[model samples]
Target: MFKIDKRYAKANNQKTIRFTDDLYMQLETIAKYEKISFNELVLQCCRYALENMEPLEKE
Candidate 1:
């Protein structure tokens, strides 16, 4: 059986997404540059964005 990361499984709720061609190409290039799989590159981006994303404060 395939293994799952405990941290990723914690975010198992279903979600929607759509990526632009430019974004896909950029990620693919980043994956090649880093010598990591495309999926791993995307995952790292998600993790990084989540960590850095700040919610807007309510007025």
Candidate 2:
């Protein structure tokens, strides 16, 4: 099962990023349901993607 680590959820740094209005709404909804901050959810998504993605191949 997927779980958000409370320790990891604590922000240590900050960066600016932009999201489309639709995407922002979706993320906000999920974060509200999960009772976590929007920042935490986004961090989890980014970490998950980086950890599970395969490397790209060169032509």
Candidate 3:
């Protein structure tokens, strides 16, 4: 399930990442389908991944 955050559009921490064209296209397609900005999609993904990694890191 995906939820939209209205504040995600605001500029907070500005950063740049380089991605392969294929990966960028895939992420863009998913972001479009989810009706969220690409930046929001990446932020959500990074947060999700980091949260899930915490317990594993403890081990």
RMSD of each: 7.3, 2.2, 2.7
Q: Which sequence of candidate numbers ranks them by lDDT, best first?
A: 2, 3, 1
- Give the per-residue lDDT digits (tens) of candidate 3, residues 1-59: 44555466765888888999999999999889888889988887776677666565445
- Per-residue accuracy of model 2 over 4-58 as CA lDDT, tens digit each: 7544577889899999999999999998988888998899888888887898789
**Of the candidates shown, which would achieve the greatest TM-score relative to the real structure?**
2
TM value for model 1: 0.59
| Model 2 clashing-pair count | 0
Q: Which is better, 1 or 2, measured by TM-score?
A: 2
| Model 2, runs deviating above 4 Å | 1-3, 56-59
What are the per-model numbers of colliding residue pairs?
0, 0, 0
Alpha-carbon error at 25 in model 1, in Å?
Answer: 0.6
Q: lDDT (0-100) at residue 21 of candidate 1?
A: 98
TM-score of 3: 0.72
